[model samples]
Target: MNLLHANDRRGEYPASYYTASATPLAPFPMLKGQVETDICVVGAGYTGLSAALHLAEAGFRVVVLEAHRVGFGASGRNGGQVGSGQRLEQDQLEGMVGRTRARALWDMGEEAKTLVKDLIARHAMPVTFRPGIAHACYSQGEADHAKVMAEKLARDYDYDLVDPLPEGLIGSTAFKGGDIDRGAGHIHPLNYAIGLALAAVAAGVVIHERSEVHSISEGARQVVRTGEGQVVCDHVVLAGNGYLGRLEGRVAARVMPINNFIIATEPLGDLARTVLAEPVAACDTKFVVNYWRLSDDNRLLFGGGESYGYRFPDIVKTVRKPMLEIYPQLRDVKIDHAWGGTLAITMNRLPCFLHPRPGLWSVSGYSGHGVAMATLAGKLMAQAIGGQTGGFDLMASLPQARFPGGAALRWPLLVAAMTWYSLRDRLGL
Candidate 1:
């Protein structure tokens, strides 16, 4: 069965705590017939919606087609951390792409953070946009390395938002030390995505739900075909991410899909202090990252573990195992909700922006650092459509590697790789 249909009800969000908290919008009609637009955007998640909103603002008619509800995929269900910089750090990025282009990418990374904060402010989104992300380390050596990376950012890039984690800041006893980035932040991602959809409608962009695109035929004008209808437009953007499947050959090569799960405990009230002393989000050094923060209701919203398979494992047991290790005190806390999301990953953990054909673009594989980068991608796409390629071109210039064994064996290979990483994480290798 198709994972999108098997895993989710068409036009509905998952049974996530995010769904419980989000202010639901009225469902848009499904595409029943042919339509024409200046741009056709597949997937109404952050990238597609943001691109539609900005493109509409630029006086282009845009239509966004979502296979499910807005934010139904990783866009709505992610860890919610608004990370700074690219998925690869500046030091590593400099080595890969050289200083000049790395400098440009760094500037864009900063722009991404600003873009999120600006979108929240300008649109007056209800999602709480809070500052600070603490990177917890498992050992003193890792802590020192974290601190050095923070310092390196300030020294090399003249960006000074990160610092060593303060004493007694995080309540986890297993952590040696950590660093916090003032530039980084978190939000109720579902609400933010819904807010984007609302804003896109207000800006006159059309959105259709339950619009699973079958294929795109490019000619003088691009024709995006759905089961029951179609969209004819001058340009088409493939922003489907993990749910896009293998529709586009180039994106499928670099963007491999995987599942990540999360759990939210019952309101901890004053006991929230036993987890996070502050409101900042926290992510650990594990390859399969343990990311958590306190919800507005004072519950611990923790996300951990990853699966390369199409189906999700036991969501509660999968995430709670790592969560308990971090906060053993919460052993008895009630798990209010549990859910899994799908996100695309690239070889180098950087986003893949592809122009597979003229007038057609594909952007995906944000890895885990998508909240800010994905939003920035929309703006960059809008800029590119308007004859500006400075930022988008730089990002597209970043290289991406294909899965080694083509289609059939990619999942097994990634599973093996992830198994080795999980072993190292267990033994602290």
Candidate 2:
């Protein structure tokens, strides 16, 4: 069975709160017959769309192919948290890839947030970009670990964005005590995604919905085949992330698709303040993280729960499990919408950027931090194809090892490991 068909309604956005609030655009025509462009981008989420937009602005003819509508995947249905740093913390990243590369990556992480905000203003997109993301902890040990990390970030990187929560302050008990990343924030993910699509289109990029890339034939030139058409281009950008089937061996082996679910509560009114005192997004320190933020309309959009298989778990129950633990006062609240989206995760939680051969590229495996970095990755991909390869090369240079036992047994292995970590979260270990 097709994984895309397995999870979501074909060619339509999932029934999510984001979909309800977003200003819908008329669906673009499907790809048919032959086409040629300087670059052919697969997947129309932030990554591919950003590449298309940046490339178009740089005067490169770009074509974006989407299996469904634009932003129909995780881009539209995420927690909307634009977090700071890589998925791995800076200190941890330093250990993995050295201090210098980690610092450069940290600077790039900052640039990603700026790029997102700049794009929002440049497009005059109707999406609201709010600042301040508070990271929550469940235990004193967790809180202390967070404090140490915050201090490390400030001391080593010369960055003072993360502030540790006071002992008896606003978010002390509910989230234990954590830190606030003032430089990071959240957004209306679906609207922002639609805005990016519009910007890319206006910049002379052609985007085709319901245009799945069936196969790729590569040599001096590349031919990307769709059901009804083909795009012959000089370069290919495989930005499909989790939804992209087994298109390339390297990406498939390195990046494993997993499902995550989110639930939106009905408008909380004055009760919103009771749930969260401020207009900041908060994510907890769990292996399977629990992130929640207030929507524009005061609804708590809570995201948690993960599945290694193709089908989504009970969305409402799965997400609400952790959500209720944090906010037991929401027992009477009604869940307005529940949705699940697939995202790629590498073993190390860092993104997997591959250039297996000349002129062909695949950048997926964002783990859970896609809002800013994925968009930045697109621009970097454009820069790489345009011959200025410094930034893109930096990302590609990060090591991404293949899953043990390859794709066949990776599922069972990861599932067992995830179960153990989830158990630890429950046990407060």
Which lDDT values do the candidates have, in the order given? 0.90, 0.89
What is the alpha-carbon lDDT of model 2 when measured against the actual structure?
A: 0.89
Candidate 2 lands at a TM-score of: 0.98
Locate the minimum summed-lDDT window of 10 residues in model 1. Answer: 1-10
Count the clashes in each prediction. 0, 0
Q: What digit string (tens of lDDT, one per residue) describes model 1 on residues 91-179? A: 79889999988888888888999999899889998877899999999999999888888888898889898988888788878989989
> Which structure among the candidates has the greatest lDDT?
1
Ten-residue region with minimum lDDT total, candidate 2: 165-174
State the lDDT of candidate 2 residue by residue for 185-240, as single tens digits. 99999898899999999999999999988999987789999999999999999988
Q: Give the clash count for model 1.
A: 0
Superposed by TM-score, candidate 2 places the C-alpha of residue 61 at a distance from the truth, in angstroms, of 0.7
